[model samples]
Target: MTSVPTPDPGPGRQSRPAPHDQRSRPVPRPRPPGPADEPFDLLGIGIGPFNLSLAALADGVPGLAAAFYDQRPDFRWHPGLLIDGATLQVPFLADLVTLADPASHWTFLNYLKHRERLFPFYFAERFHVHRAEYDAYCRWVAESLPSTHFGQQADTVRWNAARGLFEVDHTHLDEHGEAEALDRTYARHLVLGIGTEPYVPEPLRPLADAPAVPVVHSAQYTENRERLLAAEHITVIGSGQSGAEVFLDLLRARPAGYERITWLARTPAFAPMEYSKLGLEHFTPDYTRYFHALPEQVRDRLVPQQWQLHKGIDTETITAIHDELYRRTLDGGWPDAVLTPGVSVRTAGRLGSREVELHLEHAEQGTRSRLVTSAVVLATGYRERPLDRLLAPLGPALRTDAAGRPAVDALHRLELDRSVTGRVYVQNAERHTHGVGAPDLGLAAWRSAVILNDLTALLTGEEHYPLPVRTAFTTFGLGGPPPAATGTATRTAALRHG
Candidate 1:
């Protein structure tokens, strides 16, 4: 098997450019048109962690023909937000395939072993690995997995009624990212894992686009760090983990008495995440099952009330920020920094060629104020990328919820017309149907296993990946007996004599 050569380790995140000569590269070449006629067992649209997990697991199953495609030249995960010392919130066990198949060669432990860092990682006793290291581990898997194809952009997907398969059109890009050729392939099943994109609120959207100042989403913080630090004043918007990390980093880098930074959030407070033992059960498969069974209205109402589950800052990050501020006061002076919650940007305008004026409002107090800053960082989080354009061909066959979002079933299949026999699966795109676990890394392996099991069940008569009978100790709802109960309950009505 051919393999992509790994790049040398560097001080920061590192990635190798595609080979200058495509002919000599190990990257998969477009197959002949006649060979594309043979349908694959599974064709994945995106190569994010979720699909990467599926590919890793699928590699172990014999005779399973699977292929994954990504538009980028190589794998890179949130590269800009990989702040130094930042760690994944999930444990290392939440890697691509360990939770589902611990014996798999693609596990994080295996990656460490391959890199000769196993002993050091073992001695560190770190449950949460650094974010940059995780990215590197994913790249290692992508480079090694034969089923993954990079530099291929999936343009369209449509069901072929006559062929009883799904046809996917793609453009194969050359080393320089120019479209060199177009190709089409067929598949019996499809999985969409395009993932989410960073979002900037309406009030700050203009500033983020103008680029006159150092205004950027926290997703691009690393790229703009030097310019932001050199500015006279900086203001960070949003109180989530990313906002906190950026603020903390800037605070530490600036002089104690001249920090000149302001942090603002619309949330009532800079809250710590709900990381208690029982509180975390919401991320388990059990909770996902319960959420999927909920009525549309109920699920819509409940999601906003559970913001602390996924949107709050980690306790450690909050503590680090506080500790840095406290340490600055050791010389009998406070740091020149302001941290305010319950505040939001109402409107923003340019004060001059280089300064930004933000009109702010306090939600609780109903007070208003204005502030001018040389730079702004919006860490307002991300939203699911809309699938309308990609799935436009099959729009008529899709079933949508009250809000017009695709209605995803418990099995993660998009509800579609009965005429469409080939299944359309999704990953990290069903938060309304699957709850908070939809995008959580800890659930990636398990979700992949679930998808594989369902697909195999349809192909054969039995499941390929036996799902765990139970995952969480807490039962999610009261309508049914606990999952452990063997007996089934029957409801009967007493009829009155006429």
Candidate 2:
């Protein structure tokens, strides 16, 4: 990890204006309150990876009071796809504290050491461990941060006129499955680290309501994997990483002697992520600068082209699936799994007690076809829907990019015109503004640090802890910005409707 100053945009890329001059629309800074101000210094809306990382970082920072609330009762990463053998797309070093505090007791390496697998894991000589291992590591980190954890669903966030702070309304769901309880938290800063929800295509949404058809998103595969595996025929939709991974997982887990599997996707071809070292730099903080500086349309073009890097499976996984299929072919066996790319599901209707009728359009075939399957698995991916519905009245105040993504700065603060004084930080909701690494572990710690810095800067006169350049280099594990400092234009306007 090497650190550099922000760089100038390359050919065809947009250059950034100086920070102060470009967006001089006075950020509605909240006035600092007296001793009777608030209970917690900050309130984190979601306890997913990003905010989880924030909790870990906050633990070490003195006088920084924080509490994280999650809709789930306990800490669980994507439990549905916690496939037995699936591995993290990135290195295990990207765990919670390794990038931020390598020697910290809560690192994945430390978790392995504490579990007495440190030496064994090293001897295994694997770059990435099973996805289960990463989940366990995250659980360990979450458990250690218990004091700051709140198991409740935040229903809405509104600025309390009297308190002069953000009031978060939460529905508490405790262990043993009880009903909701009234719980509230007031803080000077609110961080919306709410995780993403699984997405299924509109044509398939009705299938979700059909019990007989048994439809589910790829993220929840683990829960339905056994049943889907036992089914005579399985149809998987979407060509992204999750879809591919789920299709491969099912194919590999055939019940001794299963016949065939149908994998359908809308893309023309299954594309591999850019594997070049330089290409990977698009995930670094440096890229965030370059991406933030781009014109809206150019940024839109860049996203779809680079979607595979963030949404698709790694090269190793793709190759593994290909190798397995090839082996079966060499053994005089036709591939049981059929990966149909460039096929769109036109519509789906409930069939008999156990099947779904799907009208599909194949681009190359230039024809329409119907497929009946015992089950449908949607790996179509997800959208970062507006926080407005959840924010209620606050939605009117929140700003957006030209594309309607939550407008944000490099610091992950939602761009708002006026409405509220306290800062609203978003963790997983800034992809359009922040780029591919927006929700990754590499940016988790740094983003949290920046949010905290901004919050403190707004509330108190103290500047956020200046991140040591060494930490940025080590934690990011990618090339940094350029060496020379850049300048921002005065009174420049950029579109940020989302």
Candidate 3:
């Protein structure tokens, strides 16, 4: 079998110029780098971790032209909340390329080796690595792939019936900081991984534009951390991982400094996620089947009850926060950070030059108000961007659930209108149809494999790479060695599921 050449590693996050002709050097022209006018078999909309995985999978496939585009000036995955002590919620094995191919050149292990930290990391015996480390690993992959275009945002995507292809329109600024609408690309398949936008409630939307209030989301916390660190008092809204992490980070910023923190959350208590080994099967292939087989009402009911399990922090992170709280208490600090559980921020407005007032309420008690100095960080999380904005031209042929999220096949292909010829796939936005694993890291490789298999099957009428079938505990490596008597049965069962 043939393989794609491994890309070279480099420092910094600048896009490499297209390969040059070595025979005779020519003067550079004022044109955008990379293949802008060229047609491709696949055009990925966003270069986040999900599409980055797909890019790795596509790298090994022959004659399968693909390129990814991102609006950011450079690749950055959650830079705002990469707190000094913050680590990933999932294992390091759940990185961009590991599960797809353990021997992948872009594996996190390879990244550690490149940085000469492999020995140190293993000695650490930590399943979860620092988020900063993962960010570095992603940047390495982005730097190697010269085909990726940064600072180029897709303005519009429309299906061209006459051309029998999807046309993507994008705009990027020139080196001089002048905006230019220079090109478009036609593709047989389009993968939309545009990610999500921070979700601010209706009451809080006004604060989104309030510069005085400093109503920034958790995603931008790093950029504004200095401002927040200088504040006398701050209020952090929401109780999810981001909210909790931000709260903790603020509290520990200046070990002995005086900075009051108010943590307003809707939940009665700060809950850690349920992540027992067997319980994690809900995020495995088996759970995808179990979830898909359940009745619509039952599935809907289960989602909210188990929301904490899939949506909250891992035990390690929870424990760290608990330890910090304990240490502060032992130091006689007594957690100047107040946890107003079961309370919600109703409205926020600027009080004066550097102060802000917030309307807060408790379900059991009457509504009340409070004032705080400096800023309010809204770690309210994110919401899936409406695919219809991109799929409107193709909406008539698309399928949706009662909640309006796209209805996708097992292969991750959108069930589109009959007029749609070539397939369109999605990632990071399938929470409803595919269950919790839709935006999960554990299933990134598996999802890519499924999508690739579907495409290959469409092209060659054969399954190229399929998902592994799950087996019972003893036989499938879940428990002991496979039973000698049912080895054949196990394989058959595995094949059936795949």
lDDT tens digits, residue span 147-208, model 3: 45566667667777877788776667554535555566677788888887788888767666
TM-score of each: 0.91, 0.83, 0.84
Residue-pair clashes, model 2: 13
How well is each residue in 1-498 modelled by candidate 2, as lDDT tens digits? Answer: 000011111122221112434321222212222224355567777777788777676665555666666656567888888876788877787777565556555567867766668899989998777888888777666655533344466676778767777776556565653544655557767777767777777888778767866688888888988788777889989877778788888877774236468988788877776666766766665567567777878877888777667766678778987886776677565776778888999888788888888999999989999998888889888776557666776777777777666678767777765757777778888888777888676666656666665666555655434443322232232455333322321111111111
- Ranked candidates (TM-score, high to low): 1, 3, 2
Best by TM-score: 1
What residue runs in model 3 are displaced by over 4 Å at the alpha carbon?
Answer: 1-38, 175-178, 255-257, 293-297, 331-333, 364-373, 471-498
Alpha carbon deviation, residue 20, candidate 2 (Å): 50
- Candidate 2 TM-score versus the reference: 0.83
lDDT of each: 0.82, 0.67, 0.68
Sort all candidates by lDDT, best to worst: 1, 3, 2
RMSD of 1: 7.4
Off by over 4 Å in 2: 1-37, 255-257, 456-481, 484-498
